[model samples]
Target chain A: MTRLTRAEAKARTRERLLDAAARVFAQKGLAGASVDEIAEAAGYSIGAVYSNFGGKEQLFVELLQERANDRVNRAAEIIAEAEPAEANGALGRLLVEVADKDADFAPLQAEFWLYAVRNPELMETYAERMREPRRLLTDLVARSVPDAERAGELSSIVIALFQGLVRMRRVDPDSVPDELFGRALRWLFTGAEADEEQP
Target chain B: MTRLTRAEAKARTRERLLDAAARVFAQKGLAGASVDEIAEAAGYSIGAVYSNFGGKEQLFVELLQERANDRVNRAAEIIAEAEPAEANGALGRLLVEVADKDADFAPLQAEFWLYAVRNPELMETYAERMREPRRLLTDLVARSVPDAERAGELSSIVIALFQGLVRMRRVDPDSVPDELFGRALRWLFTGAEADEEQP
Candidate 1:
């Protein structure tokens, strides 16, 4: 192991503990795993987990919600940089970037969604956070279409397509091609132009 | 109450039980709720839940998986009747129909999806069953596009789009729009046409 200064060692140890807890919680599930086991996995003492997160459930929530927020925030920041007119392509890229972007967090998220339903308070928190992504898309849709409420059926389809792509990529990565998102982007943005040229 | 034959009464009771269970499950969650409460909400005895479904977990699975299969199968049959070339359009119709078709079951399915991850065996069952619809699309894809492997990317996008739509509709029904599904269908089936219209 590389030698570490005191603060660096503490931070690294905390990160390790979080990683171990995440893995155990994800693989064995929240109810199935124990704090002691998490400590062992992290090569830390049980006191480490307690010191870092206080307890398992809170740790689980922090690992999931905070991390998801970080990701969405990063993706949204990328979207913020996009031209208003390029909203469709931008949104698609953001979503695709999110979907195929990283695998480490995806399964944990998949596990969290499971937790969200099984736990109602988490569900409320989830529902609250869910609105943020939708709100972002709604704004993007407004920019691209200029008359979203009037855009009628199109807006919902827009959200659904992004959601569908995400779900599919999760279940089977190979099935969702790299260009897949680009095609949807072009169509949602370009309308008849993208629609006709697809596949 | 109208008097009914044994079969009719049994059917009505089963339906009532399912509806009540969905509400309770939605309110209390998959893990938190018990069968007695569901039975009480249905105005039936505990025996009713036990006799019809045996337990809350099994009942939850039945509602989420078996019932969903039946609906999708029926939807598949309808899609099968459409012209071979128009199958994608048929699928779009199928998805739109699902969005509008029944409100109760959709939310339940979404809840079930979130809940399944907690139980890997259930998740596997779900993941497997979820693939059935994808298989339908895969076969349809193989037929419509001679180079199915090449179309893998497109296929996944379409599949994801459909799954995502179902999810969104449950969250906010009005936002999804009526023609959204059809539009996606038209675009997905007429891929090249969709693209050409874009650029």
Candidate 2:
């Protein structure tokens, strides 16, 4: 067995706890999930949860930060790798693919959002975490759409459209086809003329 | 006061129970709320709730149906009253206005959506209720956007954008301004050129 430094062991434990916390939060919701349950799921004691995260609320906040970072990184990579003309389509397709694969995560995200909204004290932190991803999308819009007026506003619409599709798909998956994301993105960037050209 | 007929009394009781259920469920969430609390909040007995809604789940489904109907009716009225050129902007403004006024209700809607998504059996009925509003938007898009290829798809995008904006506003109200909806709607229907024309 390889020996591990204390820092490495602590990092491993934190990762396990976050993974378990995601599953528990998704299954039982943020308000319903308890520290003890999360700790047990992570194969740790209650003290460990408190030591690492202080409480369930902080744990959730950290988890959200981690997820947001992952999303921003993935989206940045997609934009960087794709040709300038194809970046928006590639990003839209990636979002759709992630939405399909991470279907369970949507509810979890919604749950935490509600939790933060209901508790005003957490809203600032939640909003702060969201800024990075929103900025990234704004940059992408500016880069991809020529003469894109109010690129920030356009980016907000794009974000909302994606979030709304995820919610709609949850209730009626058949209604929100995989192609819808790419199609909608094209329309938003290029407009009705582009859509009319399609068969 | 005039004595009420049995049917009238039952109808009144059902309405009160539903109103109370919305309040309690919004405050406590679906899983955390109970039939007894709802009945107590409405000054009704547990039997009254059971007789009216069968259970908490049924009460929630009915609440969602009522809300969906109310949205569709409001949207229809806005479209009916506005000049053809102004209908989309009016509708978008109404959505933004509602999101501001009914901010608390957003969390409640999200909670029930999460509840429905987590339970498969409830999803079909939930989707069925959603179809009316979706169809209304589709019709509006087809009528308003000349040469609108795939109006159904465009309508879906609009719905998603509205839904997403509501979610975003809950966490970061400042980031998603009221005018953004109308601007985004115009761009979606007309394309980037329309946005660039705006001062």
Candidate 3:
């Protein structure tokens, strides 16, 4: 087995704790979860959790930040790699796939979001964390839909649509067909003219 | 006070219980709330709650159903009253206004939604309840956007967009400006060419 250096060991411990936190938070919710439970689940001491994350709320925030960064990076890569015409479709598929795979995480996300919104101090940080994904969407709209006069507003609509669809799909998956995402994206990108060509 | 009919008294009690449930659930979430607490909050006995709604879960579902019905009725009124050219904008304004006025209820709705999503049986009931609003939007889109080939799909997108903007606004009110709703509604109703005339 390869021996880990001090920094690598610390990094591994942090990752494990985050993984454990996600499970604990998802199962019990933010208010119901505790640092001790998270540490125990991660196989670390309570003191280790405090030293690494300061506290439960901090740990939750960090976990969300990491996940958001991962999503934005992956989406950026997908959009960059695809042909312009196919970029939106590829991105939509990626989103639907992620929503399906991360179904369990949605509740945890809604919990933390409510937690942050209820607490004014945390709301700022949560909003800041959300900016990365919004920015990426905005940039994509500007680049791909040059005729879209209000790219920023369109981006907001797109983000809101995706978020809403995810929630709606959780309750009734049949309501939000996977193809719906592509159709919405195409309409937003091209405009009303696309509807005329529909068979 | 005049003597009350039994049916009138029963209706009054049910309304009061629902109001209390909204407050209790909003403050303590669905799992954290109790039948006794809700009953007491409304100045009624636990028996009243059981008789009116059966239990906590049933009360929660009924509360949601009542609220959803009220919203759809109000939206229908708004659409029916507006000029054809202004119907979409009027509906969008009503949505944004309600989102602001009922900001406190958002978290409670989200909590129950999460609760229902996590439980299979509850998911069916919740999805069924959601259909009223979805149907209203579908009908609105079909009437307003004659050229929209996929009226059902457009309605889904519109509902999802409104749901999403409400959530995003809770975390960061400035991010989802009130005017954005109107803009997005116009685009969805009219199509991409609307962007070209932007100043």
TM-score of each: 0.59, 0.86, 0.83
Candidate 2 chain A least-lDDT 10 residues:
A190-199
lDDT of 3 by residue, B1-199 (tens): 8998999999999999998988888777776678899999999999999898778888988887667446555666677668878876786687677678876567777876877766777778778877767777677767745545466777778878877888888787877887787767665655523433451
Candidate 1 runs further than 4 Å off: A1-74, A82-156, A171-174, A177-179, A186-191, A194-199, B1-28, B41-44, B47-54, B62-65, B83-97, B141-143, B150-155, B170-174, B189-199
How many residue pairs collide in each prediction? 23, 0, 2
Off by over 4 Å in 2: A34-37, A45-51, A145-149, A192-199, B34-36, B45-51, B65-69, B145-149, B192-199
Tell me the tens digit of each residue's lDDT in model 2 across A1-199: 8999999999999999999999898878876788899999999989998888879988988897777456655676677668877866786677666677776667877876777777788778778877777877777777644445467777778778877887887788777888788767765766633533552
Better of 2 and 3 by lDDT: 2
- Please give the RMSD of candidate 2 to the true structure: 4.7
- Chain B TM-scores, listed for every candidate in order, come to 0.69, 0.84, 0.81
Q: Write the per-residue lDDT of candidate 1 for residues A34-139, one digit (tens) a residue.
A: 8899999999878988887869888888776666456665665677678866655677666667666554454455456556655656776765565566666566
Shift in Å, residue B178, candidate 2: 1.9
- lDDT: which is higher, 1 or 2? 2
Top-TM-score structure, candidate number: 2
Cα lDDT tens digits for candidate 2, B1-199: 9999999999999999988888888877877788899999999889998888768878888887676456555766677678878876787677767677875467777876787777888878778877777787777777755434467777777778887887887678877887778767765766633433552
Q: lDDT per residue, candidate 3, A20-97, as tens digits?
A: 998888777776677899999999889999889878888988887676456555666677778878876886786687
The alpha-carbon interface RMSD of model 1 comes to 4.7
In model 1, what lDDT does residue A158 have?
Answer: 62
